[model samples]
Each structure stands twice: as C-alpha cells, then as structure tokens.
Target: MSLDYTSHSHRPEPDELVPSRYALRIGEIDVLVISDGVLPLPTAMLAHNVDPAVRAAWLNDMFLPPDAFDWALNVVVARSGGQTILIDAGLGLDPDLNLPRAGQLVRRLEAAGIDLGSVTDVVLTHMHMDHIGGLLVDGVKDRLRPDLRIHVAAAEVEFWASPDFSHVSMPPGFPDALRSAAKRFVKEYRSQLRTFEEEHEVAPGVVVRRTGGHTPGHSVVRLASGGDRLTFAGDLVFAVGFDHPDWYNGFEHDPEESAQVRVRLLRELAANGELLVATHLPFPSIGRVALDGDVFRWVPTFWDY
Candidate 1:
C-alpha cells in the first residue's frame, strides 16, 4: 500500500490552560488534586545509568518529548474531621524563579472555594522548593496561613536548616537557588513547624510515613478512612521510574536509598491496589500501581469530566 505524504498547514494554536483541579472521594474523606502547573525538565537529568541513545529511545517509545520531560506539580487537599489539609505547597509566586509555568496553586485553590486561612495544616513532603514554595505569598512567607500548623519531617528540616547545607554540593541538575528558597521557607515556618519522626498521623485520617532518600527527610502522606486508602507518593516515582525502579534521577539526595524506597513502595502499592497520588506525575495524578512482571506500571484512574 502507498501512503500519502502531504502535510496540512491548518494546525491549531496551542492551548496552555487545562482544568487544574480535580475532586476525588475516598470513602468519607474528600480529596482535591490541585495543579500548580507543569515543568519541562531536561530528559538527560532523569536517568544517569542509561546510555543517551537508549534513554532517548525509551522516552520516544512512550511518545514523550525526547529533549525534555514534562513533570506535573499536583498538590493534594483533603478535608477530614473538619480539618482542611494541604499536602505539599506548590511553587511559590515568584516570576524570577524561571518557573512562570508554576505557582498557580493559590489561584486554583481559591477557584475551588478553598480558603487559605481555613487550611488547618500544610504538610511538606520534602524540603524541595516545588513542594514547599506555595507556602510563600508575594515573595514573603508571613503572608500565607500563619496560624496553620506546618508538618515537616524532622530529618528534612534538619538537613535543610543546617548551616552546612548551603556549602554542600547539591545533587546533579538540582538548582542551588532552590536551596536558598527552602531555607527561607524553613525559617518562616519554624515557629509553627511541627516536625515528625517515623510514622505518625498529621491530620484526622492522614498519616505521614518517612520515606527518605529523595531527601534526608522525604515522606509520603497516606489517607485512610472507611476502608478506602490513598497514598500521596512524593517524588518516589517519576515517569519511567515505575518501570525502572532502579533508574536514579539527578534530584535524589541519596540515589541508592531512593531506589530502595521506590521499589519497596511500588511493591506495596501494586499488591494492595491502593490509589497513588504522585506529585510529579501528569496533572490530576491519581493512579494505581500494577505489578508488571518483576517491575511495575502506573494505571491512572479514570478521569471524570
């Protein structure tokens, strides 16, 4: 058979805006998946072990941009036991940060009828800027919900708050400016910060589990109520990490530890069929992990218009 090689000049202009908020019901708890925006990271920064050609081929097979990878900033908002809880604050409102595509959490929250003051708690899954940046408003931190309690992993806080942290070399491809921003956030919330070690419940039905390696104190938020369960997997698996759990990203503080945690978490989620809410997955990033042979695969939940 012969194929037509003609091209059309009537391509539509790109639409950048997408429905950024999604409401999910997990038993008695109401969860909102709020999108700050998408970030385009260089693909070369993802897997350090894979050859350039193999990595490009892998990304190409998945129909992703071979040059840059699209990472979504999905924050979680949960209402349980009369408490409004925000999982991880999105990138803060800073135009100079070169993240103009992000920092939309506040606007999106208001659009969803979420009042910042009404949020009783803000959980920092890790000390990374993208996770805690939304805690600042107008380039200053005090303008945010000052009365709300901020939950952070003790290890994460100590690492970022250390005087030596600024002098240490950041992971490959990780921006140094983010370290400065993270320090500011830590100082701003230090008064209201409640650091937790090991597993503990931060809110009514929300439990924080220490899953370090991505950072010294990286954690995941687990929500369970009325037999329904959902996990907020913070940077545990991004893009192809599910299929290749050993693939180390340049952002990990401890690549080996990160891989171990990723593999362990993926196994548990895949076995139990619990909903996995990833921060850096595609927008509205709610899904289930399925065991594909010895590895795993992401099965995004059905989208409801």
Candidate 2:
C-alpha cells in the first residue's frame, strides 16, 4: 500500500503557495480554517455609514488603498466526537460575479485531504451567496451524502424567501445574484435542511447560536472543550469593526442591529479572552479581542509552523 516515490515534483497544485488550510485544537475538538480565497470589493463596503473622509482616513492609517481591496472568505471544518462539521461554504462562481478570484473551497478541501461525503453536518452562518454559493456549484451536490444534515436558523431561511435589500449598500447586481443563488440553494437542498430556531449543537462542544444582525438568522458557532474555547463569528465582526464598531458594513441587512451586535460581541470577547475566528477576517483568522482604550482591537495569533 506504500507506493509513494520520492521523485515527485515539489511544484504545488491547487495554488499551494500557502496550501490554504490551518489546523488547531480546543480541548478534544479538532478545528481547521480553510481559505476559500479572497473577494475584491470596494473600500466603501467597509463602512457605508461613515463619512467618505473618515473612511479614507482609517484606510490610510491601516496603509491600505482608498479604492478596493481583497477581503478574505474563510471557511472552517471541525471534528468533534465523530462528526465532521463544515462551518460555511465559500463563493463558487468567480467570473459570473465579476470576482475573478475566490470560490476555491472545493479544490482546497480536496487539497487538505477532506472528502466531501465525510462531512456529517453543515452549519451555515447565513445563506448569503458568498457563504453558501460553494454548495450550489454544478456536481457539488452529488458528492455530498444524501442524509447530510445542514443546520441553519429558521429566520435565515424565511428571510431569503422574501429578501429585502433596501437597507444594504451592495454593488449593483449583487442583490439579484444573491436572490437567485438562495432560491436555487433552497430548491436543491430542501430535503436536507435542518432549521433551528435559536441554537443547535451539531457535535460535542460545537454549538451554533443565532445572532440576528448581519442577517435575520445570522449565527455564530462556539466550541468549548475542557478549559479551551473559540467562537466563529460569522460576518458579524470585520477587520475595521475593531476601530469603529458602529460603522456599518455595506452587507449588513440591518446595519443598526448589526452594529449593536458587533459591540456586544466585541465586549464579550474582550472580556472572555477566548480565541476568535470570523468568516470575513484575514485567512486563518485565529485571534483575540481586546478593548484598546475606547475602540476594540484585534490580536492575531501567531502561526504555529
């Protein structure tokens, strides 16, 4: 069975410059953060509520361009007890959305030696196109188990049924694209949808709780084992959120509520000191929150090899 030859070329496939996955542990749970690549978005999307000059100033302070930048799409895989859970799927179409990059979840998962059928549960943070599009790709459904359980908040499913975009400031075509994607996803996966009202535990120490702000049924997953803990804050908190928690991201369905939720979560995380990872933070977004005088701060964890 050992048929490997040492002569294999070192060149990487699947764009293996960094190989796209990070692994860590919390007590008995095994967690993996996978990069689905990055999406290039307008700088305004970072904070639509702030004055243009203020937004530009913050970007300048961070040494970033005042135009557009690549926002990472992070996906997580966790193994607790015998269940293999997928936190969120990445965007699957690139050119279709005018996003020439991203949608690499499927390829990256295979590169990391994870078989699609092995995933026992899928916990969607919300049904946004970027978060659920990877599952709608052609032939992707075939690779999944027929009995697979997809856990999502009941409000999330209902919101997409009649989505309202009056509050969001997304780029043109995004709202339409999102609606189509959500409708198609529901049609294709209705049989496996496992809707939860407020919270659900997919595996030991892995609990997903609804936190309505980003989306009506938006949720976050928390893992606690022994004394270790981590929270996967899906789209609720962003990189810029630390410096300006009230500044509204363009994607939030309810910007006011989202800001409130952001402040609350940031305060909680700052107080608890548990590890934090977010869907839109940088790749392998393992970090902690800290209250830096007035605004919050993001303290990233050093990479372990």
Error in Å for residue 144 of model 1? 4.2
**Weakest 10 consecutive residues, lDDT, candidate 2?**
1-10
Q: Give the Cα RMSD of candidate 2.
A: 3.5
On TM-score, the candidate that comes out on top is 2
Quote each prediction's TM-score: 0.89, 0.95
Off by over 4 Å in 2: 1-14
Instruction: Report the Cα lDDT for residue 89, model 1.
Output: 91
Native-to-model Cα distance after best TM-score fit, residue 19 in candidate 2, in Å: 3.5
lDDT, candidate 1, 1-305, per-residue tens? 00011111212124434577777777788888888887767787678777889888888889888888668899988888877788999887666657778888887776666767678888888988888888766743544566788888898888886523322234443565677778888777789898889787876789998888788899999999888999998888887888788887867878888899999999999989999988888877888999888878899988864
Best by lDDT: 2
Per-candidate Cα RMSD to the true structure, in Å, reads 8.5, 3.5
TM-score of 2: 0.95
Instruction: Report clashes for each candidate as comma-separated counts.
Output: 0, 0
